[model samples]
Target: MKSLRNLLLGAGILLLGSCNQAPVSAPAEPAPVDKAAIVLENIMTRASVRSFTAEPVSRETLQTIVRAGLQAPSAMNKQDWEVRVVDSQDKINAICDIMKKANPNAQDRFPDKNSFGNAAALIFIANEVSDQPGAFSAVDAALLAENIVLAAHAMDLGACIQAGPLRSMESAEAQAWLKSLGFSENYQPMLVIPIGHPDQEVTAGQRDASKAKFVE
Candidate 1:
C-alpha cells in the first residue's frame, strides 16, 4: 500500500512538472481607446444647421444639454449667465413677428416667412451684468452657448447660434415679451440659439487655415 501511494505521488509530481508554467498574465487591458480622436471628430462633424424639422426636443434631453452648458468654464467661474428656453409656440411666433418687424429684409433673406427657419425651440443666453471689472459676462455666456451647441450636436440635434432674436427682442414689444417671460432688466440677451432635429444636412466648407499662427 505504501509503495502504491509512492507511485501515485510520483505520477502526480510528473504530471505537474510536465505542465508547469509561469502564472498566466491577464490579457493586457485592451489598448487604451483614442478618446481624443473621437472628441476631435465630433467637433469636426458639427455644423450650424439653420433649418430644422418640427420635432420638439424633449425636456430630459434639454436638461442634459443645459447640464453640459452649466459645466462650461467661466471667467472666475462666476458663471454670470441666465438661460431661458422658450418652447411655447406662441411665444416663438411672437418673437418671429417681432423679427419680421425688426428686419424687413428677413423675409427676403430667408425662404420661410418665419425668420427663425422653423426651429423647434429657442434657447436664450442672457449675460447677467457682473460687478467685477473685466468679468467678461458676455464671454462667459458665449462659452455657455458653445457648450449647449456641442451637447445638442452630440445628442443628434441641430442648433444654430443666432443674433437675430436678441435684435428682435430689443423693441418695446420685445421688452414686454421678455418681461412676460420673466427675464429681469439685468439679464441682457447675449445669444439666442435655435435647436431641433435637423431638416437638412450641412457640410463644412474648407477652412482658411492661413490666418493661424503658432508660438512656442
Candidate 2:
C-alpha cells in the first residue's frame, strides 16, 4: 500500500508539470480594410442640401469644420483664406435684404430668398485676392470650400454652397457690414456655406466616369 501511494503521488506531480508546460498561441490578425473605397463612398453620397431645420450647429463643430478647411492645399502653400461665421438672425436678415436689393428677382432664381436657406449659421469663405497670382486665390478658396462642405457632411450636418450672396457684398451697405465684421479690404468673399439640420433628403446624381480618357 505504501508503494502504490508513492506511485499515485508521482503520477499527480507529472500531470501538474504537463499542465504548466502548455503551449502559447499567437493572436489573430485583423481583417484588411479598403480605405479608398470608404473614402469614395463618402464623397459619392454627399449631396447639396437646401432646406434646413431651425436647430443650430454647435461652436465646437464649426471649429472642427474650419480646421478641416484650413487643412486644404493651396497654390504655393499660401493658405490665404479666412472664414467668417454668422449666427445672428439680425445680421442674416440684413444680408438677405442687401441680396434682395442687388438682385430683385433673386427669389425666382433661388429656392430661398435668404440666400442661406435661413440656416442656423452661415460660413463665409474669403481669400486675400491680392496675395495670389492670377486665379490661384479663387482656386485656393474653392478647395477650402470643398473641405468645409465635406467636413460638415461627415459630421451629419447639412450644408449648401452658394455664391449668390457674394453679389450683396458689392453694395455699400454690405461692404460696411463686412467691414464691421472685421473683414479686410483686400479679402474677397468667394463662397457662402449654410449649415444646419437637414429638412429634406437629396439623392446623388449619376456620374459618368467614361467622360475622362486615359492616354496611358
> Which one wins on TM-score?
1
The residue-by-residue lDDT of candidate 2 on 22-123, one tens digit each, is: 587887698788989877877888898877777888888899998998999998898878889888878987877876777776563246535677687888
Q: List the residue pairs that clash in candidate 1.
A: none
CA RMSD per model (angstroms):
9.8, 9.4
Q: Give candidate 2 misplaced runs (Cα > 4 Å).
A: 1-34, 108-113, 131-135
C-alpha TM-score for every candidate? 0.79, 0.77
Cα lDDT computed for each candidate against the true fold:
0.82, 0.81
Clashing pairs in 2: none
Please write out the lDDT profile of model 1 over residues 52-132, one tens digit for every residue: 778888988988998899899998898888898988778888877876786666553357525666788888888987687
Shift of residue 94 alpha carbon in model 2, Å: 2.0
